[model samples]
Target: MKLGIDRGSLVAWDPDGEEWVVVGEPWNHDLPAFLADGEEAVRKAERTFTNPERVSGRAPSGLPFTPASLRAFALWESHMINGAKGMVAAFGSPGVRRLVRGFEAVTGRVPPPLRPRANYYREPQFYMGNHRSVLPDEAEVAWPSFAQVLDFELELGVVIAREARDCTPAEGLAAIGGFVVMNDWTARDLQWDDTRRGTFGGVVKAKTFAGAMSAVVVTADEVLPRWRELTGRVLVNGEVWAQSSTASPLHDLGAAVAYAARGESVGPGEVLSSGTLPGCCGLEMRRFPRPGDEVRLELELGAGKPVTVTNTLGARPRRATQARHTEVARRK
Candidate 1:
């Protein structure tokens, strides 16, 4: 029989149902009952997260994870040095709670307060930073500038479940919290301007920025075929302009993880967002989010509630990069 969601009475209300239910974590705890022996070890706190079920009613119809979940895994892993399965053993038993208590007593922060709900945080944006470059999609937040090629990229984000340093690709998949739709806004004008001038890795300023990411998390909660087709749209003033999908993403989770691991250690809760699709930005269409204009970004996760984002474009938007290459070249 389906185990009535009993995460040690450590459960949250289904935002949709308003009924107390077990908050699904990244993992499907179908192991043995012994794993939950230390069920009492779990505590309640403010947090966010959900599976990919599109049943909408009261709560926001998206999967938002709490930072607390990551902390819990960290503490458990420390004790279970052997691996996480051992952690399940520790929790199922009664003494597990005492052990967690002792650990908490030493380090005073409460165990699992809940992960912070990240707001529009990413490495890219409508207006790229530093140069104040103009990204392809409509800019919700004004930046420096956008006079050149307006562009956007289609990318993917790896929602993480736990954090681990020096992890491998296999570990990355095992530790991922979940998968969420991500868009790294960009500033094409700034890129074009900077390209003719000098170095430009600072593109991050124009690319990932807070609130740039759409928080529609898709965990393994719902039944999904191998690849799900979804529509991505960036609109300005009620016009359906930019269009793309998760299928258009150039990089996948596994590749990004392997590449990331080559350089630095990975952590839990970190998102590896896909950059941007090929033709979904202004650079290709030659449009940008001007001030006073309303920008609506919506992702149609077919048969699922589309993830929508609407922000008013700021007038006198910020400039990303104002490089007078011709004047400088002429002067020299």
Candidate 2:
């Protein structure tokens, strides 16, 4: 079954009536209660004649559920390679950029992306994302005051339905509750700098500012069988900017969650992302959205209605005083 959270209430879509209907008085207003109640919620929603009250025309403003934690994995090598070139063009020094361009011109073949250690192929490469910062669908995307280049990563996120630990790929896959479209907002310059200068190559301010997920969610039973076959598009200002697909990945969703479960427990409501799809982000496409631009992400999850999330970029914040480290005078 598909569901959305509207003002902390669970709302299900009515395909026949072409409207949204309150699923039920969910125990807690989100996935936990819905998951806990299982088919009972669907059964209640099905009793339309008995409980017939259409929801307001206003769209849902919240994610189907609040994720307990967010974990994103780099699963597409195509995106990595193309994104490497974009990083160089956008952040590399002029001389370095020219040299790479010259080399490509001379060789007539693009070099491999300057990313990923050999171990990338050995296991799933992932990082912990800030769940607390996730904005609901249609929320204005606040511009990061410290960043000049704002970007977006088109991805598919999986919701965990139950606790898992030391599970195999199959078991990990079984723990999935549903799927949602995700926008992993990024600060290109900050991310580059943090990964290069911070301790252990951190991704702090670069990634944690804010992220977003579609309010709509399709249940595991409906999306799992064809999740990989899903197709998507990225639109800026209502114009299609890029197309993406989930036909290929270095590792499957099962492996990603399984890797996370190793030596630790992954609980219900936690989210796992299928990293940026190839050519789906501004970084890879070499185009950034301006302030007030509307960025939309659409994914066909094959459950009758397609999942989409849209947000407008907010204006950049005013400049502020620069921060500097304190210095101590040298002693003779």
Best by lDDT: 2
Off by over 4 Å in 1: 1-57, 61-140, 145-155, 164-168, 202-204, 208-211, 220-228, 248-251, 301-303, 317-332
Candidate topping TM-score: 2
Please give the range of 10 consecutive residues that has the lowest summed lDDT in model 1: 70-79
Off by over 4 Å in 2: 26-28, 36-59, 102-113, 320-332
Give lDDT tens digits, candidate 1, residues 217-261: 444222123323555777678987777655533333444455555
lDDT of 1 at 244: 62
Tell me the tens digit of each residue's lDDT in model 2 across 93-208. Answer: 67878888887899876764465777788999888999999988889988877876778899998888878899999999888878889999987776666666788554578789
TM-score of each: 0.52, 0.88
